[model samples]
Target: MKTETKIMASILIFIAILLAGAVFFLSGDQKTMSQGEGNQLTYKIDYSNGQKIGSDSAKIKLVEFSDFQCPACKGFEPFLKQALTDYKNDILFVYKHFPLPQHLNAKTAANMAEYAATEGKFWQMHDKLFETQEQWSALKDPTEFFIKLGKEIGLDETKSREAIEKSLYNNLISRHKDEGINLEVSATPTVFLNGVKLKLQKFSDLTQEIQKQL
Candidate 1:
């Protein structure tokens, strides 16, 4: 009788262990599903002033930290642009610079972008920069190209060049970086939506997330 009881106890312990393992597996799966449903952009983030474009008041806001020379950033540009166009009334997108030191032209490009912002042409220059990335990327005279591009886009070339020289938006750029660092951004093209790091895997993923927030 005692031997029989021991055998039953052992069986029950084994069953309990199996049940616990199953629970753990299921919990992990649920967590993955939950995370997948959220913003795919993974980066630590902090905000300052919060007065920047797209930050003040919007149904949904996306903050993108990017490098001008980053291939990934370039690749993701189209999807981002589509988001802006598709959700113009529902979403506001903000750009931040996190130019990597390895890219020789990235920092300069960032500076130029900041200067463009001062001229009230940030978005226009932003589009031109990304559209003409390949042309100016390999050249040593990227500034001239940017200047010309600005003129083509109705920006005052003389004023634009002067803005770049004077670094008019230098403080704003620095503020963006400072805020990004505080937010724990360690990479380029990190995006956040409504204060959450987007978990977006593709344009579709972003669209779904935006729909939820809206």
Candidate 2:
């Protein structure tokens, strides 16, 4: 009888040890997951080279990785503009190039914007590109329209054409795309607010987050 009792106690002790080990492992895994979430929330975003739309010293910085030819990006543009207007005093908005492979005119548009940047008219060109995205996106070759838009924005036709034809800003566009890739950006309108990636369901979602930061 004593022997059986000792054996039962031994079994209970073994089960307890197994349960304790599992709890320890699960707790360790939870800790690792928490750390990963913290890291993602605090990931650093680089905005040194993109087009800026607001004061650089603003407390809230909103960065967007965008493709000019993307329909969704086109849809998001108005809300983005409104955000800029609403938070004009408190936000620094930056647009970074992330032209998707499927969008034929996206890279060209990015190049044109970069050329416009050289002429100090990037924001104007940015608005023109999105405002007229449908007209140029369907064209087999949009260079002529790009030049026309450039002229509208007061950029020198010769310099703009030269920049577009020779892809003078291809390297810069590629750099921005690379930066977006490094940040795991796979879509046209990936947005980051103050270095944290935001999954925006509505315009108010963005504004609420901005208000929190402000």
Best by lDDT: 2
TM-scores, all models, native as reference: 0.68, 0.80
Clash statistics: count for each candidate: 10, 0
Query: What is each predicted model's overall lDDT from 0 to 1?
Result: 0.71, 0.86
Candidate 2: residue 185 lDDT (0-100):
89
- State candidate 2's TM-score: 0.80
Candidate 1 residue-wise lDDT, 150-210, digit = tens = 7887777787777666756567667777777766677877888876776567645777777
lDDT of 2 by residue, 1-214 (tens): 9999999999999999999999998676452233324465444676678998778888999999999999999899888877888989998888999999999989999999999887788889998999999999999989999999999878889988888889888898899898888777899799988777888887557778788787
